[model samples]
Target chain A: MSNQKLFHVAVVGATGAVGEQIIRLLETRDFPIEKLTLLSSERSAGTKLTFKGNDITVKAATPDSFKGVDIALFSAGGGVSLELIPHAISHGAVCIDNTSAYRMDPDTPLVVPEVNIDRINEHKGVIANPNCSTIQMVAALKPLYDRYGISRIIVSTYQAVSGAGSRAIDEMLRQSKEILAGNTVEPQILPVGALPVKHQIAFNAIPQIDKFTENGFTYEEMKMINETKKILGDDSLEVTATCVRIPVVYGHSESVYVEMKQDFDLEEVKQLLADAPGIVLQDNPAEQQYPLAADAAGKLETFVGRVRRDLSNPRGLNMWIVSDNLLKGAAWNAVQIAEYIAIEQK
Target chain B: MSNQKLFHVAVVGATGAVGEQIIRLLETRDFPIEKLTLLSSERSAGTKLTFKGNDITVKAATPDSFKGVDIALFSAGGGVSLELIPHAISHGAVCIDNTSAYRMDPDTPLVVPEVNIDRINEHKGVIANPNCSTIQMVAALKPLYDRYGISRIIVSTYQAVSGAGSRAIDEMLRQSKEILAGNTVEPQILPVGALPVKHQIAFNAIPQIDKFTENGFTYEEMKMINETKKILGDDSLEVTATCVRIPVVYGHSESVYVEMKQDFDLEEVKQLLADAPGIVLQDNPAEQQYPLAADAAGKLETFVGRVRRDLSNPRGLNMWIVSDNLLKGAAWNAVQIAEYIAIEQK
Candidate 1:
């Protein structure tokens, strides 16, 4: 560890939910860091965060914040990433963005390290992390995709409040308490859209995650559809998604139905998933063992279970995938990319 | 109303979650009942319930409980139905069962009043109500099936805890309070199965609903599959389901993917649903209006929204369906069948 090459790292949106996880991952993984810089919006600029038993005060992020920084991780929002990514690139720093800004940009690579790490080398400056729901799904299915080719996917998500941000989490908790206390709740932060309407997230399921697109799908659903194809490098693959938000605090659970190109054995399919990288198989029907969001919270690995052959279509398979939305879906994925870059540079 | 002939009615499991809803519907809808008899297990036998402002004492359900019953409604567990339904039949009572025991029985007619009311006459003695999750999906899709022949269906459910029973609802509420207080919870009554494994349903999603069948699907999933085919009266229709238990208290939401035998116009599809019986169309993406479980709670109508054509298959459509599992899914559906019987007899 002492002989490794040390690089300077900068974390934008350091006070945000995903950004906090990124800092924690970096500290726990013992990443070779010569120096660390924390950057947030001016509203949160003066906040001090502790890392490795030392205090580092956050500064307001600007185009000039990337100077001398070897790698810059961004999760503030799409607006911040779109405005500052070019400056970060011109300063000779590779950017790992955790927003929708550069994800579908043709030049930028959308990479889930387990699914498409090779594409990380093709990035001009930014490697975009797929949506939190998409990351766990593709990571769990990549092994199956390799074993037997996949032609189509239909997915329905039970997503958590944390994917929307920390405020959404607080809203769910507060609303839940309010409902439990027999009071009417005023929803303020869910189904985050341009409209004034908000739905209660406590004891409810909100079908809309982001604003509706022209095609009648929410931005979150379209992200899962478009980003899955991009990360898998298969534009011809068919994908449809319905993303719904539940009251869970951290993990996102997905019900995935995939139509394979060839007929496969169910036991072999289970074994392939069990052997996959970054995927833990928890499917034991006799024992009633399956993935639950509460169990997957704070974990880095994606959990897959409830594997069964579709009774209607011979080539179709059904399974459940779960993961900590902020961990594998955002922070750990970005950190894995940074680790790959560190190894390549060394 | 004074000229109508009234019949003696009995309600098994009168104190249950679904049974309570049934009694409320009976009172609100002004059903022509000459006498209302409330029956329960030996444990809750003496519970007092008021119907039409008359106090009725609950009696322990037994083989002789239906001796003079002209119409009997059963919402107790399947064990009670399987054991006592035949006795009700021998005593000449036409039973409307909300349990799965007689749903697939060839002699019994599984009736959803809006979908297959005509089949009610074929019942030997019992008319079976479909599973709660299955009831809502089929209700929403029946209009579409009539307009465009449905070839296949794939559904993923976000079900409420009350579907299990009143005890499960209490467990969820208690668990949520414990979690809010930052204490660990010991789950005792969720994922109700033969095995002893229980999952935390507060702020979590459980993939298993009932016990797993030999085919790797839960009994709840199989109930949705087999019951849909039987109710639709089409043995060739293909169906698949993934039933999940969420933290909600009342309504169940479904994400359904259906492929039709004929091509469909999206606007025409919306019009058909809006005009259908017992279905309310809440689908206006421009106004961010879609079906939500929280909003659907206590409502008897099945709410449909988020209708869109599949990106890959021209004949395929995706929709979101929500309904109060106790009302439209169970109690209201059973009552609709009883109403039809009363009208037929009159």
Candidate 2:
């Protein structure tokens, strides 16, 4: 134990969903920490949370909150990350952001540890975590891409309501109850974006996950397309995505079809996926076993199944990918990078 | 109105979800029905349903039930269809079967009215309605396929609970209430297939919709693949599908990507869809206008939106297609065929 060097860590947005998960993971993983500071917005600063049998009072995050902090995790929102990430980096803290603020920034390496751990060394001060939907997809695709060159990708997402936030989870639960009780439901917080018109997601699927871009793709879909390319470090690869938010509370499921540049053996592809870093292969169809959103609620690994070669395109492969949006998608991913940095420091 | 010929119509599975919708559409459309007979299994027999301000008793469907029946709509289980359809045909009743029993039969013409209405003439005895998932997809793709010549198609579905039947609807509603009340839910009816395993549909997505084939695709997915080919009368076209069941009570939403053999003009494709029959284009992304399951529920028209050309494959196009699974997908389509047959006879 004495050979391990402990570091001071600060968790921003410490009261939010992904932030709370990050704190829980830090405690459960027994990360080497000499001191832990929990930080949130002014509205939630005074709240207390127990970690390692100690009550830690969360403080309002500001530029000074990063003083002497070796690692800072940001997950409040994109705006908060843009405001506080620079301050944390200036204070000599390596920031692992869970927001999209710096994911596309060429300087801040977008790391999914299993896919691109070496890229962490190129991060100047910040390492951005990919979107929850993008993280699970690239993790499953990385091994396949390495084995057989991927030329194009098309994905359709069945995303959990929790990806919007805790409020959206509450909204879905509330709406479901209201509809079941024969009462009218007024939707308040789904499709979280700049749009004023809210759609009911209690028992429905909404195609727009985020605000629409100049092209027809929503911001969430664009994030998957761009973040995947950045993490894979190839801008020329073709990617298209349709992001839809379902009533699921925890896990995000994706139906991904990829066209490989070369023909490959199906058995080899299955073996490669079975041996991938943070992936669990659950592709037995006869027993009716596959990765489902319910079974993937709290797990940290990406669960992939239903792998088959496309009937039409011999070079195309299709698979279903599922993972907990808060874990592998956000919290655990950030922690993995932090662990890498700690090991490199030793 | 007097010049129109009246016919005796029999509705099988009259107590089920799609059966109820067929009766409602018949009443609303004021179809020329001289006598209406509601037929169900022995379990649902003696139940009474009102049509055109007249109460009709649902009787046990047998060989004698089709006596003097000019047109019959069958939505019962596949076993019942296989047993009763031959008897209905022998009695001179044109059967429009909504089950999968005879959809792939060489003599049975699979018909989606808007796409292949002329095929009704070639039906030897029964006209098979495509699967609920296949109906909406082919309806949206017909115009595009006609103009650009489709080479391949890949689709992922967000299906409704009601497609599994009325019991599945009750199960989903009950599960949602139990889950919202923080109680344990015992799922009994989702992914209704030969498998005994049931999955929770409340706030979760089940990737398997039907019994898995030897090739790892479910029967529902294979229906989408084979039905598209037969309905289009082109066996060489490539198609693949992933069918997922959500908690939605009505309406099935599809994320479809089609690779056209020829280059397409995006504006021209939009115009083609807009000008097509039984298709509604709601694709203004600037206003967050897109087809949603909630909006498409209980509507007869196939709602299409989010039409965009793929960024990676110039010849590939992506669109979101949605329709009430019981309406345009089943009941309304069957009724449309019946109306065409009546007109052709006159």
Candidate 3:
């Protein structure tokens, strides 16, 4: 091997759904990792998971876990990140968080590599990844925004179950089987929020993704609205979102209607999207081709299809965007930030 | 019993999903029915069903099926309606069609009973029921349109599999089980358009509902756009729709964003919607109470919830509308028309 610097990487929440994806991606991608530290909560501390064909035991993520860590990727809950991120920073480790703990914070730059990779340089010690639904939309819409100057966005999402965690995936699958067998089921962990009420997610759609805020918007919707403006570095853009969770296991699909400040030709807009980075255009209606969540389950790139000019408005455009919520939405975005940091260090 | 003038009613496609609902509604409602004639295609001609504890055999629908029929409810395919509606009209039967064959006809009134019952008198032998997705939206928005005057509507639907037909319901159920069991499934009946491509509706969402027109909007989407303007009687109203089929078995849900011509008070708007006939208000965020598809199934009223004013636009509002696709969306709408006809005849 060439003599290149291999940095020590610490992965917190290594056993969770997105954390698992981060570990798998790190093992598969060409990253310079000298030591791989898999850290989790106390419940899953002793679990053994293999990475790069070597068995690694998950350790409890204490403040000292990042003693020699060069870059730490955090996918744990917000409370864990809040308590431990400062400690990791004190130990001279850069934190790339996938949770909503510090996304809207002015100090922590929210990064979507496809949309705003340059924002990584502005991070003091932590760079937050945007929400799963927001990541795909911004990534797909960045090209359009750069070309025609977006004014407003109205998006309705068809989110998957995996965004809730692995437990939610289990809950959806179990509830589906029970419903299919004519057996009743009690929902335990859906519409994950501060409330006690839980709605059924089997063969149904839940409109509220997170808890409702004071202004009658869900926390998840607010995250999309706020983080989109932050990531695009435009505070004046008008954005509205209706975040919905469907029974799909992995990908999140959005029906986005955007209004542009300047006029746009439909053919030129399609060409712009086709030439954009990290976007795959799939909009042939005659062949029944469009971006589907099932087809985008394991893929890293965002899929954009059903692109058409809005019938009523001259400058409005409609599109359907799909991507694996875990990979591109969370893990891969964090890893891409970490890779950028690694390359800068070299 | 009150002596009401009983009319002979014929239900074409009686064995189909919507046709079955119409028969049941006729049995339970106070409609004056002297004779009930069940008609279907040749394949299902001999099937027997019960109405008011009396057995009726399904007859093959033809020109003579409406010989003595005072009002005929047609839910058969569009081809059947296009071919046989003229014969029914020639036989002096006032046809209330549930198919799209006569929906866009200038002479045929596209009716959502709550929104356009007064237009029933203008029908020239055939009154067309609006699309299932359109029926719920217009019924929910009629009050707002009457109060503040709607200028534009942008809607995204989470439609049910039942909108496709009974066979689609079976396919969704079967594929859901196969998917839960980790077996591969071949989709056959979903995205029920002219195209040969089929998508798995078990845990996925299909963006295309009906066949796409030349402009890339699906027929279902176009139906929502065109039918909204027609049913509202405002050709100047701007409307757009993205119809998507999810895994729900019944009850279509829509995330609707509308721009009103006049300003609206949120509390007064809620009061107006709550006081509106044939509309249910279910918007309480604190208790996690909202209109759910599972709860809306088999209900007659359209449920409106999550009503809020848009943060950016002064005249914009966002709401969630849901209803049983088979009830208010189809059979009940037709039956409501037929009941008006009976009242007028009396």
Candidate 4:
């Protein structure tokens, strides 16, 4: 450990939810960091956060903030990533972005470490982390994709409010208390905070996650659809998603139906998932054990359960996948990539 | 209205959630009833409920309770319905059972009035109401099924706790309050109340809605799969469902993917749904309008939205369906069947 090469790392959006988790993971995982820089928006600047028993003050991120930084992790937002990534790259720092800004860019390899870590070398300067909903799904299904080729995926997400950010989580808790007190709720944030219409997320399900795209699907749904194909390196893969926001604070649970090209044994499929990297299989019908969002919260591993063959399609499979949207979905995924880059440099 | 013939009506499980809704519907719809008899389990018997301006006491249901019942609506548990329905029928009462007791019985007809009202006449003695999750979905898709001939369906449900009975609803409310207060919750009623293993329903998603069946599917999932085929009268049609329980109170939301036998024009599909008997189309993406479970609560009509064409399969269509589980999913569906039987007898 003493002889390992150390590097300077900068965490953009350091005070945000995912950013805070990233900082904690870096400290707990004992990453080879010689120095750390924290960056956020001007509103969140000057916030002091503890890292490895040392206090680091967050500064407003700008084009010049990446100077002498060997690696930069960006999770502020798509707009901030789009603006600052080029500057970070120009300073000879590799940027691992946790935003949608560069994920669809052909040169920026959309990498889920467990699924396609080799693709990390193909990145010119930026390695894109897939959407939170897509990360847990691809990680859980990578083994199945290797054994029996996947043709199509139809997913319906029960996403947490934290995926929309911290304010949405606060709104859900507040609205819940208000409803319990028999008071009428005036929802100010939910479904899409940017959108004018706000639906109650307390004791209800909102089918929209991000703003609606031109095709009737939300941006969140398209991210899962497009990013899954890219991360798996399957241009011909058929992926469709219905992303919904439930009142949960942390974990995102997905109901996925995948049609495989080859017939596979159900027991062997379960075995493969149980043995997969970064996946925990909790499927046991007799004991009533299955992956649940409340249990998956704060966990780094993607949990897979409810594995069964579709009665309609002989080669089709159905499974429930759950993971903390902030951890495995966003922060942990980016850190996993960062760890790979750290080892590669050594 | 005065010329219509009146009949003696009996409500089994009158103290239950769906049974209470049935009583309200019978009063509000002004069904031609000369008398209303409310029946419940011995535990809930003698509870006084109001109907029109009068107070009626619920009685413990026995075989003799249905002696003069012209039409009986049953919303009790499956075991109670199985034991009492035959007695009701022997007393010359036409029974509409909301339990799963007779839904798949060869001699009984499973009716979703808008989809298959004609089959109600073929009932030997009891007409079975489809499961709550299945009811809203088929009601929304019936028009599309008729126009384009659906060949297959894949559905994932976001169901409310009330479908489990009033106790499950109370558990969710209690758990939510506990969670908001930052106290640990001891869940005793969700996922399945009878199952030994309990899961927290407060701000979480439970993939298992009922006890696991032999096929690795919950009974609720099986109900959706089998009941759809029975109601649509299509043995060749393929349907698969993954039923989940979220922390909602009254409405159930379904994300459905259906493949039509014929190629469909998207606009025509929307129009067909808008013109359907008991469905409301709430799909205007530009204005951020869509059906939400919060808005669908207490409504008799099923709300359909997020309608789009599948990018992979040209004939495939995707939709979101929501409805009050106690109304269109149960009580009202039974009442619709009862109305038909009453007119037939007259």
Q: Pick the candidate with the highest lDDT.
A: 1
lDDT of 1 at B188: 93
| Cα lDDT tens digits for candidate 3, B195-284 | 589888889999999899999899999999999999998999998889999999999999999999999999999999999889999999
lDDT of 4 at B233: 85
**Alpha carbon lDDT at B208, candidate 3:** 90
TM-score of each: 0.99, 0.98, 0.99, 0.99
Steric clash pairs (candidate 4): none
Between the candidate structures 2 and 4, which one is better when assessed by DockQ?
4
User: How big is the RMSD of model 2?
Assistant: 1.2
After the best TM-score superposition of candidate 3, give how far the Cα of residue A186 lies from its true spot, in angstroms: 1.0
Q: What is the DockQ of candidate 4?
A: 0.87
Question: What range of 10 consecutive residues in model 1 chain A has the weakest lDDT sum?
Answer: A189-198
lDDT of 2 by residue, B1-346 (tens): 7788899999999999999999999999989999999999999899989998889999999999999999999999899999999999999999999999999999999999999998899987799999999999999999999999999999999999999989899899889888787898988877774578888888888889989888778889899999999999999999989999988999999999999999999999999999999999999988778899888987899999999999878899999999999999999999999999989876
Evaluate model 2: give its lDDT: 0.92
Query: Judged by DockQ cut-offs, is candidate 1 incorrect, acceptable, medium or high?
Result: high
Which digits, one per residue and each the tens of the lDDT, describe model 4 over residues A134-193?
999999989999999999999999999999899999999999999999999999988777
lDDT of each: 0.94, 0.92, 0.92, 0.93
List candidate 1 stretches off by more than 4 Å: none
Recovered share of real interface contacts in candidate 1: 0.79
Model 2 TM-score?
A: 0.98
Which ten-residue region of model 2 chain A has the weakest summed lDDT? A188-197
Mind giving the per-residue lDDT tens digits that candidate 3 earns over A142-169? 9999999999999999999999999899
